[model samples]
Target: MNLSQNLIHEIKSLIAKAKEGAIRSVDHHRTVMYWHIGERIFNEEQQGKNRADYGNYLIKYLSEQLQPEYGSAFSYRQLELMRQFYRTFPIANSLRSQLSWTHYRLLLRIDNEDKREYYIAETVKNNWSVRQMERQINSQLFERLLLSNDKESILAVARNEVIPTNPNEIIKDPLVLEFLGLKRESAYYEKDFEQAIITNLQDFLLELGNGFSFVARQKRIHLDGDEFFIDLIFYNRLLQCFVLFEIKTHKLTHEDLGQLQMYVNYYDRVEKVAHEKPTIGVLLCADKNDAVVKYSLPENNNSILASQYQLYLPTEEQLLKEIRREIEILNKNDE
Candidate 1:
């Protein structure tokens, strides 16, 4: 590039950054203003507790007085939301400046304090946009991560209280792929699925969890004149390991696990340096037999994992059922 072109690029970058900063400043102030409104409303309601339906009356009255002046932003519904926002995050200092009011609005939908805290930590840590956080919440990302992980440990990792040492800590089972836009009824080959992932690589990385970076596609390995191709590979900085993914368009079998395990071994032995952790292999299949997966790997196996993939998001009922089933399986194992 010529000097003029380089100068122009630098100027554009600077302007873009300045605009982004200005937008963030506006959002932060908006969030703070809403919090103060909520706090005032809550205090006023408390003082009028003897009146019947006082809280509702107060909010409704406030909405009436403020709406004409402030517009729909202070409507009854919005005022109620602001009231709940203050109740949810009682301490103003605890509010995250990186998150806008929309982010907190989405978080208010979650009733569980632990779950809400986990999402807050993740949103701030990952710097997720409002839409990205919404998708994660709708996909029940927290509940999905709990499938093979303990709640406390998962929260700890999200809060950065502890670093993830194992794949189960960060990698979710039954990965959601609704963002890929693949129809559930349509048949797709492994190559097609891999191609779709590549096309929506950014969303895929988000679903893959933290610290993931793309490495290769159809990465070839030759062993004793035999050529083999791994579907996709990623590096996770948090785990400090290479993650190998083998896409299976059908139900996972013992052979598939064996193949992924071999790729993981190859990566650990050939690709990884001494300071890095062991390579983790995952079988991304359309369906999976958990019993088969259990018997395929050793009891202490931590590196090799299998995750079923779905083209569509699961309903809340379906997610609850899956979680219950996983819990039952864990209980049976203990027994």
Candidate 2:
């Protein structure tokens, strides 16, 4: 706390700040530069559109011409990526400074416009690093959300343009727990799984999606003469409600739904304030029967839901197939 020590600490802090600022500046500049290169190459390719060999040799020739002076960053593969980046985000001004060239490189892999845009908006809003963005996309976070929602609402939430009001908006079905390092084939207790989630709380929150804050684990609640414990408690700011979760290591049943419903009622009556929304309860289990779920809850009930949990990441092909199937269903419903 001496004056000299204080000065040293202040100078060190300033130096760290400057270094971070410089790194960010460099990343932003690199991104903008790549965008310009992509723009130039795209224009050149358009001009050569009439030629048969135009598109085939454009990147290779460009790489040969530019790599010598510009270095490895202009390799044929990198050039193609740049072209893809430009194609994904045509307007240079639409690119975000918060994202780097690495981020866009991963995003360019996504061919679906809505999914790509959703990832971009979520990345910026969540301030996800390139690695985080990659993990989310690989885990099919958008598709998982789509499992519970239709296209319009899911896309709106992805864009961060609309705040979610209902519990369905924020809750994802079949929560991916690969980050927990749990084995799908092995038997595990709910307590062990909950502990794993607590250990990787950051990833859990990310998986939970926007506006969730962890409250407690095995949160204690007491009634007239008995004690009750909620497995996990989270508050969603967007819904302005408490999201109480009951962890089940087995198949979801009417009993499981009833327990969660009781928890939801307790939270709504005891924990929630007058102005706040009703508490939402989620029964996260190994499996769920849709018909059972429909019969377990009231006909118009939206407060309680049951979702399955997958210990491993679903393959891209699997997710795409599921997405296509769901879209077809939605289209049929529309008609």
Candidate 3:
């Protein structure tokens, strides 16, 4: 580029960076301001601790006094949120500057301390936007991860204390695909579903978990004049392996697992380097039977997995049921 063009580009980049930095600075201060407000309110409430309703009365009174002057930002509800925020995260230094007030507001909804910590670590680690974090929470990402993995290991991975070695550690089962805008009632061909994933690739990646980069769609291979195509391929930097996906619009069967296994074997033999791990084969089916999945693969098999996919986000009832079922399976295994 010419000197003038280069100068203009440099100026634009500088201004953009400055604007982003300023926005971050403002957000950080606002978050700190709310924490202080919460702390002060808590201190005042402690003085009147003898009265059962003093905390409520204090917040209501403060809201009335501040609302008119500060507008609805100081509403009684918002103040209560601030108070709860402080109670939840008492250590001021523990608050992450990378998170904004909105992020904290969403987090404040979670009552489970362990769940809260996991989300906090994941949000910061992934640099999730407020909306992305909300979607993840709504989809019950933490609960889903807990289905196959233990809580301690999950938290350890989220906190970066140890790298994820197993595919199940990072891959979520029953992948929620509400963002694809595909109707649950509508019948979609495998090609159409694949196309939708590509169209909404960004959201797909977030839902897929961390360290995944899209490689190819309908990745073709040949074995002695017989050709095959894999639906989707992704390389996970964290796992240091290729993740091959086969989309099954219908219920999963042993045949589906066998097909994906063949593809995984091909990648491992031909594409995987010496330093890389074995390729993981995932059958992204619309439905699955856990028993069939279990018996289809060898008892020691670790590379092939069957994960069901839902076109819509699961409701709270569904999430609770799934969690209960997963817990039951774990309990049965222990016996």
Scored by lDDT, model 1 comes in at: 0.92
Tens digit of per-residue lDDT, candidate 2, span 85-123: 787799988989888899988888888888888888888
List the candidates' TM-scores in order.
0.95, 0.90, 0.96
Candidate 1 vs candidate 3, lDDT winner? 3
Kindly list the per-residue Cα lDDT of model 1 for residues 187-302, writing each as its tens digit.
87889889999999999999998999999999999999999999999999999999999999998999999989899989998999999999999999888887899999999998
lDDT of each: 0.92, 0.88, 0.93
Find the 10 residues in a row with the least total lDDT in model 2. 318-327
The TM-score measured for candidate 2 stands at 0.90
RMSD of each: 1.7, 2.6, 1.6
Higher-scoring candidate on TM-score, 2 or 3: 3
Top-lDDT candidate index: 3
Which residue pairs does candidate 1 place in steric collision?
Answer: none
Cα misplacement distance, residue 284 of candidate 2 (Å): 0.8
